[model samples]
Target: MDAFEEYLMTNLPEAPSFHPVFNEALQAMLLAGGKRFRPRLLLAVVDAYTPLLRESAYPVAMALEMFHTYSLVHDDLPVMDNADLRRGEPTLHKRYDEVTAVLVGDALNTHAFYLIANAPLHNDAKVALVQELAYSGGIGGMVLGQAIDCWFEGEKLTPEQVDFLHEYKTGRLIAASLKMGAIIAGLDEKMQRELFDFGLDVGLLFQIQDDIIDATESSETAGKTTGNDEDKNSYINHFGLEGSCERADALAARIGERLASFDAPLRRSLEALLKPYLARHKTK
Candidate 1:
């Protein structure tokens, strides 16, 4: 993972533009740094199954990170969450302007597909990778989740509804990261589906843990704006802190059991990447 982070840092995609600061704004959030959890999930799968292909898989892993970063940029826009900080730095809109922030997000979003399209993989695999990412991050998945979340702010929802919202908003992309890795490694559809299902649980647990963080941690500690879910339908809002923690605990256990079911190599790689994250809710 450390080596992968180094690779990501040095290999940010370039977008030549004549407009002043356009290129700079485009790279700001990405270079500011993030957990890169989604990319790690993708690369871990590739490493476990096809160690020799790790280098080739770097671009695909980077595409996942780029897509995730674009989401964060848009989410922080004044029209959405209106956040001022992200990844421990001023958001694009705050650093530049709303127009720059919006365009930068759009650029990252489209360039993510471009990365997959040009990845050093088979034509069929590249097509599959593009399809998987687009569906997961597009209107049917993450976009729909965000729409539901923003449209229903200050409105309480059922637990099942909340799950549905997060599943699309957060879970699908995480699931896609694992499944996309499986596609690159030529894993059969059955195993890919299994990994995707497990990833959804992990994603849900992540959202719940984030809610706990928003409730308990400071913005400085979180490296982003905190306590921003007060009007939004968050797990912590639906279920108080204790209940949300218990829910995260149960979900983490389920993820653990699923992780154990995988073959040894895959399990080991994912365990190393995910163990700390699975139990993050308990840390606070």
Candidate 2:
């Protein structure tokens, strides 16, 4: 595992792009990266069950990052989140024009499936992955979430409504990333169920952390625009700070207990994945 981590860090730069334009977009997104959480989660589940598939895992994981980057790019447009900062740099829309940002997002989104379909993977599995990515990113998942959120803007929403906003928008992709890795690793029904639950809990807690960060952190600390969600119905607003903390701890504990079925190394890494949320004891 240590050796693999070393390899991941060392070989990250070696994945060559086939064209200059493709490489340019990939490089810009990668250089202005934030957390690399989705790709890391993809690698984790694949490594848990099928370490031999790590080579394929890289392209698969890279596709997740690309797809995620596209979402962020479009999310920051004037029509969407209107974010000015991302990964501590000007957002694509801010650095470039809105048209370029839109194209950059479109390019990344399409290129993700492009990489997946052409990856050194079995045809059936590649098709399955492409389909999953499409559903998760399209009207069924992230887009649905965003639509709900945008529609609900300026309207009073219950906590359930807020959860609805995030479950599809944020949770869907995170859950898909987990399930996709499990699928690639050929996990059985039981493991898949466990992972799905764990991913949901992670996603739920993640949105909570996002809300807390918005209330507490400066844009500099968060590496993205802060205080954005406060304008929207938020966990912190619905549940007080103490209430949100309690919910976060309870969610983490439940998810942590699910790790009992996992191996020691995977459990350790999963714990690390939860740490940021757990230790996010206060706002900034």
After the best TM-score superposition of candidate 1, give how far the Cα of residue 282 lies from its true spot, in angstroms. 4.9
- Show where candidate 1 strays beyond 4 Å: 280-284
lDDT of each: 0.90, 0.76
lDDT of 1 at 17: 61
For candidate 2, the per-residue lDDT at 159 reads 80
Per-residue alpha-carbon lDDT of candidate 2 for residues 235-259, written as tens digits (9 for 90 to 100) = 8888977888777778767776777
Q: Considering every candidate listed, which one attains the maximal TM-score?
A: 1
Point out the worst 10-residue segment of candidate 2 by lDDT. Answer: 6-15
Question: Which candidate leads in lDDT?
Answer: 1
List the candidate 2 regions with Cα displacement exceeding 4 Å. Answer: 1-26, 263-269
> Residue 208 of model 2: what lDDT?
79
TM-score on alpha carbons, each prediction: 0.97, 0.87
